[model samples]
Target: MLPVFRRRPRYSIGSKLTLIIGAVFGLYLLSVTVIGYVMYSQYRGFSTLASSHFDRAMTAAELTRDAETIAAEVFEMLVSSERSINAGNRRAENLASIYQATRQRLDAVDASDVVDDQTRAELDRWQQPFFSSLERLDTRLAAEQSLQAAHLNRIDELFLLLQQLPPVATTASLPAADQRFVGHALAALSYAAAALSAERPGQIARLHGACQQQLQQLAALSLVSKDFIELRKRLNRTLPSIFTSRRPLLQHGRATLATARQTRVLAQKLTSTTFNYHLQLKAAAQQAITVHQRMIRRSLFGLLLASLALITITVGAVVYIRRAIVLRINRLSAAMHAHQQGHDGPIPCEGHDEISLMGSTFAVFVEARRQAEQQLEQANLHLQQMNAELHRLSEIDELTRIANRRRFDQHMASVWRRALREQSPLGLIMADIDFFKRFNDEYGHQAGDECLYRVAQALAGELHREGDMVARYGGEEFILLLPGLSLAQTEKLARRLLRAVRSLQIPNDQAEGHMVTISLGGASVVPTTHDRIESLVSRADQALYAAKSRGRNRFCSAVADDQNVMVGGTT
Candidate 1:
């Protein structure tokens, strides 16, 4: 049986980052995102609930005011015969306007946003009776006005009949004294007509007594002339109807007044309920605020734990990967350098992790066959090729054709240290494509990649200065470094980059404005001992997140109004 040697699996840089750093960071990010989303949803719910409660309160108040005004109008109509016709019509117009306005406001209010279905149903239950009462009140007022018109017109007709009725006598001739008495009675009726027309209830009541006195005097003529008997009989016939017409007016008045009272009562009840609902929502809002605050504290605790875990995982992964790849590569380089100098030392080919390390060991085996002189030259060539491969892998993003995450990490660290040593500000910008994941889904991965390539080129081209650098940080995110730049300069550059990408007019159906756009978060800082390079990156990240939150296609700074942090916009 032949002995078998199992080849060890060598993990690539990307795979290692994924298994350890990526996994930890992804968990932290997901947790933070979920917590933020929950908080935002809670805030939205609170705000909407508060707004609905306020709107309902205002509407209730308006309804109450309208109901009161309508009731006042009903009261005014009771004295309608006393006021000018235009005045009465104006009141009617006002009542209608208020009622319509209140109804519109009520109709626009949707209580379902804050309250439960059961509460909404209860509100609907209350609304029906209240509005129905208002409608009934409106109807009763119309009936009352009609009855008033009928009553007044009946009095006018009776007065007219009194004036037209001719004297009745056996000789077909009436005495002047009888005629004078009839003329006096007709004059008193004319006065009653004048009072009724003026709508002066007090004058109408006073004229009632005068008109009665005149009728009494005319009654005396019954004994004097046969015409007086017919006039008196005809007058008697109308007096009953004129008196009876008051019954309908009184009935309609009572109905209207009763309905107005009912409307007012219902309106008051509805208003009280609205106030109670507002109070309830206010109390609930307070409770929600407390709950939100607790959640914020709890989320903060969770974040701290996640951050610690992320740091631990990151440090461990960095140590292991650096030791595995970098240590072996360094040792191989030393070996090659030693062989070239004709100084042969111990070249320990210990690890299975590095294929390059394995290849170096194989080259040593052929040293005797090819002769050490020739092998040294070949080893130098191979080492140079290996270094070039490692540099390429370390710096370039495979997909975006730009500087990768490794370059960003290395560059940011270097710049931060340089800033710390020189005491100059370092500007960092973190940018994200708005709705990029949706864009990717709509356009397909091929188009998305092409879009990224184009966007990266545009972004890279924007950095004309030698001190400026652009790198593909991650999915749909890019980072730029501008060393020795102030916040204003960084903000200006960020907006310029934003415009540059947006100017491409890359068709992104999923994004707002129906085109591809980028949101940038910018931060410039003079390094301090207390903070790490990640602090500046975190600032930029937060600003980027803020830009996205504000509807995207803009720029934001970590410090909202701090003199050291300037924000810009567009695109």
Candidate 2:
């Protein structure tokens, strides 16, 4: 044999490619890690700064809302105080509790680093006057309430004297002049009483003067009885006290009003200050975001320049290896494209290279894809079935197996809009199973549930119209939406529903007739853009209350020609 040359070591295309790719990848990974570390550090700093600003902003917003709520509650307390003194006291106590809690919150905010020094100083400045004004308001309100009570008691005493005089003046033993004096004194007392009731302090003062003069003339009379002298003495004591109390009551009321005005002004100023501070914090957060975004853009631009250089080096290396790798990859790519276009065939894999391995993987993937497609089709069908079941379950009551409140609400909204468009009458009936709670107590919850189910079914059976819908609104309560029905028609249907449930004869020892019956309230209204569905529901609710009040097992219409009428059921 010709001299056997030593076989040269084989360097495959993959080994050459690995060397070039590993160098390029290592350089790219190093640059990326360094850049990412720098960017992440900056991002973390920006996030912390922005988070602090946002937290402070949120705290300021909460302070503003609390201030507004306090102002509203104060105004409500003032208004309610005019009607009932007990109510006023309760509101005042509640206001005090709310104020104390708000004060604690303010103190916490002031002590915290959430707010800057300037904001903290402003808050401190606002807090002192606001708390002072609130304290003054509380004092004046208490004093006014106390004086009012004393004034009422004194007026009652004066009335008692006036009532005693009426009997004395009618005594026939008195002289005509003394009788005239007693009559004039009675007139002055009456005027004073009227003035007090009407809250005219000036008129009361004038009446007090007239009464005092009359009292002196009566005391000088020779024909005065023991009762007359006693009455004059009581009046003399009572009028001066009443006169004294009235002035102070009036003064306290004025002071309370003035204090309330000052408190409201301070509260509004606090709200404005906090709101502005919140806006400033928000702006600072935005500025931080803007600055961070600029830094990110600059970092990304540097990263992009480095990436382009790496890509240029990668392209030069790839061009050298293109003939070896690109031709085989293109062949595999064409096969994948054909497979995508529904031409499923085996990939022509020949060499033991990376491209050949990809071909084997693609073959396995094709088989997996076929199985996944079948599974996907089954999953889609199952999802559709589940969705339909969920929709049904959502609309049906689990306990009653009737339309639930959610379903009723949706239908009512749609029907309301339709009625508004057509300007037709829409009627609603609110019905309750009478003595259901007591029935639950007598029987058990299971029996109560059965009762509700039967009642819901009975009510639903009574509605023959396609547009009529009966739904279980809540526990033992059902609502019927009867569109296109007038009030008369609604009432008629309500009566039928009442009788239908009574006909069931469900026994309950707690209920009247020893049977379960339902009370129905019906309201009908012609739809208008100005009318709200809530108003219609409220009217029906009122009618339902009327039905219950007139004794259960009856139908009540809210209004028939501006009159409430109830249809009573015979036991």
Candidate 3:
């Protein structure tokens, strides 16, 4: 792969910085552009949806209202027909005229399609029964009037209750109180003219005049309010008196009947129109709400998608840059340190990517740095040696000369690696003075130092070959490295050292029984193969723990074949 996009050197640092800034800016712009596209798409969809639904809802509302209005007007006419007929003032002809006008109004409501069959039936029931009752009352009155010219006493107080008969029992029934009943009554009245023509000619002419006057007055009655109660009462009494006086004297019984029917019809019409209008408005409002919610949801979804895409791109960019630059820099930095220490080979090259190219360039820089480090290393070596000597001088107790921590780490790595490569059996022993800290307080730091030195000497004396090495591991601890030794031999040497140290009888005031005892942990491994350094150390450490657990003044050996663990000593 190519390392990186190359830019001309003629572009100054400022120019390069500007270009990088532009690239970052362009990424932001692209995000904004995508978001804008989403928002714009949502806006268009919402606008289109709103426009279509709004007009439809409004039109339906208007049509529903118009149909209900016409139904109300027709209902009024039907009620008036009853009034004219009962008063004995040519009521049938009057009905026939108003009925025609009411029919024209009802035809408009039918065209609007808001009224159903049930509504039509209700209207017919209210108007038909009422108008029929008027005709029946007229017939009864004419017969009674002709008989009264022969006999006068039949017209009595019993005639007053004729109006009190239930409307349902009449020739045609009256409407219910609600608005739907009013619409039904209106539809019924629209066809009343044909029914009225069945009345006699002299009565029909008088009925035509009565129907015209009643229509004018009933239409005006449609505007009745509580505030007009007095005016309504006066008109009610006056109109009935004038119309009733013209009737055959025996027809007086029908007065209240006609008035009641007209009232019921008016009430039904007002209720039906108001209720239908209300339903239409509610439907329109619901449609608007549904459309609004859809628009909001679409916009929110667009925003969510855009936000997710932006986050994904941002995370991807961050990961790519980190792997490309940060990880490579860290690897290169580690390799450079090892080379400077004269401890490792050159860095590896895996690709021609920017990180790889940078690594290659850094390798050259490190080589030059290494030459410089060589001169520095020589000076550092001399200084390090002096520092080590100084540390040994201060820390080494006069009685026991062994490697301190300052010197131990400096030598352990080299010796351990060499032993591993040679495949020689290597043995390690860790010896600790039981209760050394208490012993030191009981005695003194000098006495404690002396006691430690003597113990170290005892361990050194047990060693028989040049391959065996002894060192003071800590204030009251010592380590012995024995090469070419098996597990049995290493244990024997450790036991001997423990015996020698015990014989010294160093004062350990903290001891409960035998004082100044020691514990030894040993490991013997053939170093012919390169095993892990940590694993070897861990095995030896485990052995030391076994010895300590068994009690002080003992030695533990790790069996290398099956890695058998044993703590062996005379307790």
Candidate 4:
């Protein structure tokens, strides 16, 4: 409480306007500075996160390609082994040769170092089962071959008897030689068909024809030509289905044993391939590591550069402000002191800030009062003037002259406190015009300002509480802080507000509907629950974003129930 000045003041409107503009611009600049630094930090973090995932994808692709190529080679080798076994005249020698060859191939392939233990184990599992099946087929084929040789010898003995015996007395009286020869030939043919079935007897007819050519000569000596021809035809028909199914069993054994050997070759190839790619990726990762390090270094350098720039700007601002504002204010303080002591002089005015406006206004008032001192002493006129100024300042938007963020903050605090004490819910709604910058550009600056005012007035009328208040909270963003309301109550209010704003239907070609409409987000919470004021406001802000995302001209509410978090009034 200083002594009341007997002098009055006059203010220069130009100086006052300039002061307001400078203060607003400084605040905007500071906010941009802080946001820029935060964004750069986030960008650096995201880049590092993405690089880590790239490394994993590269490793997986390299491993899969190596495994597939090796498995293919093993399949080809097994097919070759099966053909050689089927062609053999000697059973034991042929099987032994196949076993030795398969074992040698397996050993040679297994000896080479390739792939990891886990991959080797995978190859071994299929190999073991296949080898067991092949061993069983080999034993069966050997037994069949032995029976075939015995059947052939029995037929030859019958043929010898047929040749040495006396000729058949007559066709009606069948000789024992004739019967024995027919019986032996049938047994021989049956044995040959059974033996070939083990060798994938699908080709039995061709082999049977080869045998028949030799037997056909014997047909000239035999009286059983008709029976023999019938037997051959019957055997050929039965062989196809049996041989087709058995072919897979014989194929499986040979394939697995052959493929098992191929897996070793494949393992070596995989080891080499894996090692090669590993080297490549390691080199690439190293390069990436270097690049990452450089990026980190670049970020550090950028931070340093930003820090230096900030420091330089801050130093310049401090020096300039001291000369432009602080020193001027100090000079005005001295003039005010002299004026208070009944001496009057023009107050110093050099700055473009609120203090400078006051100085100039005071100097003018002092000059005017000097001209009319007797009248100034007559009434309490200065008190009224001071109150008017205070009221005007309180209502003035600190940033844009349309109700300050401070007013919103203060009203919100009061509304929240009352809502809590009463145990009634408070509703907070926020709205942001979509593509406002584009709108601002399409419409001139003056038009943009007019649009904001129109939107603000629309919202102001919708705030029903005596305790409720509407104010501009951010650039082109408005907040409606409501007291004594439920979420349903808030949403209903929001819907009405949206309709009212849409009714104005200001021309905004950029808007999807080609009409100016606001996207509203509202949050309502019973004040009984303890929560920070910032968090409540944040929730309302999120709801506003939801409304915008769902397309503008909509109202969304942040309401949480046991069922779900809500976007509008209901989930």
Candidate 5:
């Protein structure tokens, strides 16, 4: 021999499978740990970037809105009239408060780490000028408001003097010429008052000239009253002061306009700065997304590689298992299935593996089970025949061979439900031998049983409809279920049944006509959820009593009333 080499030790399928599965599980665990770590890191980074930038951007937007609103309010103050000045000032104070709150919010945002030093500096630079412009605008607005108030006061004084002159013109003590001069003065005063109200400078000046001419003419009249002279002196003092107050109100309006322009420019600059800051945030967010995308792609690439390796390993293991073990197991399974279905083919039992041992054991088990199954099937067949006979005997009376009380109850329930669903009439008949107890007493129990069987057969044979059924309710009593039969139809069928029983002519010495007969009490009703099946049975029993009370061998029908069953009619 050149060189004798020892054979490699053999391993069982379980050991080899465990080793392959363990290796696969280890690789899977390593891949999952690496992927999970990379994904978690990327998620944390993205979450931080998104939250910080989104919050800062929202704060910047709020600041921009407040700034524009403040600028609009300033312009509104400048153009407002004296009547609205106080209201505008109140609104201005509220806007200033809002602007301050917005600034505080911006400051809070700037304090966060999201804001860079350059952005904070730029924002601070814009905020200072914006605050100063708002302050200057507020000051000019206050000055304009004060001038308006003073001008209104002077106008009020002029109106007071004009009112006093009206009473003087109405005085009867004055001469006619003096009265005419007083009227002319009152007319000029009215014109002046209108001019002041209109806020027209030229109209006020023209009215002042007309008033001066009227007062000078009245002074030339020596007959003027002492009161008139005093009133004229007061008018002369108040009118010129009203004219002077108008100039300052105009100057304040011009100053307020200049301040509004400066405030608007500052607000624009602040808006621009906030917009730029927002753009920066958007760019930073985009950059973060790009970087995270790259990370995600790398993670996905690693996952794909891991998945491919797992797939390759799994496939190789599956091919090995299929060839080594699964094919044999499948053939054994198929053979077992075929044996169960009555084929006696052999099971696959090859190799020294566990499956081969299992297959050999299974072949013996299959034969034993098949023999047992055949014996069990014969026993099942005999048991099924006995069950069918028991079921039949349970529902049918032994002597009469018709349905018994149990079957009657089940049929009543089934028929009632059908009638209720279809909204159809269900007719029930409670039929008895005309004198059943007397008949049984006169004859023996054997003859009584024979009579009951004959009567049951007669009733069942008389029912023509497939849905109709007759059952022996108890000793010497039978019930009929006629679905879709009205009271009239039920009575007609009951009469036919009575005749059919009498035609049998089974002798009963105690019965009517010395022959067998039946008295039928029948009731028909449209079934309703509110009504009970027992109610129908009771109504039929009542009608049966009525038929027997009237005469033997008759059929009586009953209808339902609000409180009780009323005997409808008899046939």
Candidate 6:
């Protein structure tokens, strides 16, 4: 069965090439059209976001500065017997402006442009300071993290202690009352342990309720556990200690838990406001850019397939066309190869035919790809800088502008361990303002905050040593860690700390000195494997108590003996 296959009549080479060049140019135009459409859509979003973000951010900046000026003017009005009426009027005007700007930013800004992160430079400036509010939240988070660690450790210890005793008598083996109490107490301990990680406001309320329940269970268990211990002293040896460790949490844990809840709430509010603002802007930009990139890639890939097929077909067609036409085809191939090698070598664009148009289209594609890559790189860099700024803000204290408690703890621990290894003496001074509570009661919290700032600065100024650090321990209390300082050096430093506060000479009628002053207790010791931190802290506290007892505004030192414990007295 032999079949004769007849070949279809071949078109002229010019006809074949006309079709190829026309089709490729048509694809080029389609790509250009689609790209224009995508660009317009993305540009609207990007530009609106940029402009809106810029305006609001600038407005916020201006308002903050204006507000500060207004505050200063009010202070001047208060302190000066003869204040400038013009300054007062200017203050009023700035206040009004700030109020209006804040209102506009919060409520009246255009809905579509509500969240824009267009200007990186402005965001860089604004976001860093805006995130300063989160410094307070960071302190709270560190406290919560510490609480969580403590809770976990106690729970683990409670379990280990529980393992030392026999399990509860089975329900069948014991009286109903005994069994109920034992089961409920165990369940409550578990609940209390689980509550440590609950962060939501609702979760905190539920946890409080659970804590109440746990207390009830503990009360019920107390009677039974006591009776059991009375009956079987040796077998229930660890139960008393376990209950001691576990029961106080139900009673005294509310403050810590409430603080944690507040921390979580504040952190959520602050981070969602600032961090998420940038985060969403970055996301939107990336998404639009990613879509644009995908479209470009798809176009480039389609063009690649078309070019390959066209070249193959046109090469064959050129064989029939002419040698001169064949030379143009070779030039086109060279251009393709150069593009592949990341070169935009000269393309032979001598004619106004389809091949010349193809060369132009391919050049545009290469240029667009390069531009897209550069844009993506810039976006990535912006995101990284914001992240770094956030991290830096978290470690700083926004108010007192000193090392916060968390920083102090970290620095102290690091220095302590290093000093321990080097066998160097480390000194810790715990100091507090005399009659600060009374000062707050009389002058108010704002005044107290100002006083704290003043005292912290004065204390910081005294510590010129490289390894010395002063930190705001809490309200009205500051701690200083001086590495490689002996008892004498520490006492000298402690005295100097007291003098610094006295130098402030801020009027405080409640204090014995008739001005703001501090009482300091210092402890210095060489680290030992056998020693505990509590021992050193206890000595310092005893000295502090002695200082408070003797009188206010004095320095006291705790001397260590062979027992590796502090003996408290005035130095």
- What do the candidate models score in CA lDDT, each in turn? 0.70, 0.76, 0.57, 0.60, 0.76, 0.62
Model 1, backbone clash pairs (residues 3+ apart or across chains), number? 3
Candidate 2: regions farther than 4 A off: 1-11, 16-51, 69-122, 155-186, 197-201, 213-236, 268-276, 292-571
User: Higher TM-score: candidate 2 or 5?
Assistant: 5
User: What are the runs in model 5 whose C-alpha is more than 4 Å off?
Assistant: 1-39, 82-84, 87-126, 155-187, 194-211, 214-233, 293-330, 337-343, 350-352, 360-571
For model 6, the local distance difference test gives 0.62
Report the number of the highest-TM-score candidate. Answer: 5
In the predicted model 1, the residue pairs found to clash are 81-199, 82-199, 168-227
lDDT of 4 by residue, 335-388 (tens): 989998998676775544566667767867777767577566534477677887
For model 4, the superposed segments whose C-alpha errors exceed 4 Å read: 1-380, 398-402, 561-571
- Write the residue-wise lDDT of candidate 5 on 433-488 in tens digits: 87778878888888899999999999999988888999998888899999999988
Worst 10 residues of 5 by lDDT: 1-10
Which lDDT tens digits does candidate 2 get at residues 373-403?
8789899999988998899799999999889
Candidate 5 local lDDT, residue 96: 65
| TM-scores, each model vs. reference | 0.34, 0.41, 0.30, 0.33, 0.49, 0.37
RMSD of each: 45.7, 56.4, 27.9, 43.3, 30.7, 67.9
Question: Which tens-of-lDDT digit does each residue in 404-476 have in candidate 6?
Answer: 8888878877887898799999888888888999999999999998999999999999999898888877778
- Model 3: residues with Cα > 4 Å off, grouped in runs: 1-399, 528-530, 561-564
Number of backbone clashes in candidate 2? 0
Q: Which digits, one per residue and each the tens of the lDDT, describe model 1 over residues 1-571?
A: 2123326547654576568766767877877886788678667766754576556556655655665565566456554543322254456456656766775675577444554565445555665686677667656666666776776677777667765656444224656766766676566556545553443346556666666777667766534666566666666566545544554565566676676567666655655555555555555556666776677787677778767777787787788877876787677778767766767765556645444545445455535534764768789989989999889877998878789999888877888888999999899889888888998888899999998999999999998887688999999899999999888888888878888998999998887778899989888888889878887888888888888877788888876353223355553
Clashing residue pair totals per candidate (backbone < 3 A): 3, 0, 15, 3, 0, 1
What TM-score does model 6 achieve against the real structure?
0.37
Task: TM-score for candidate 5, please give it.
Answer: 0.49
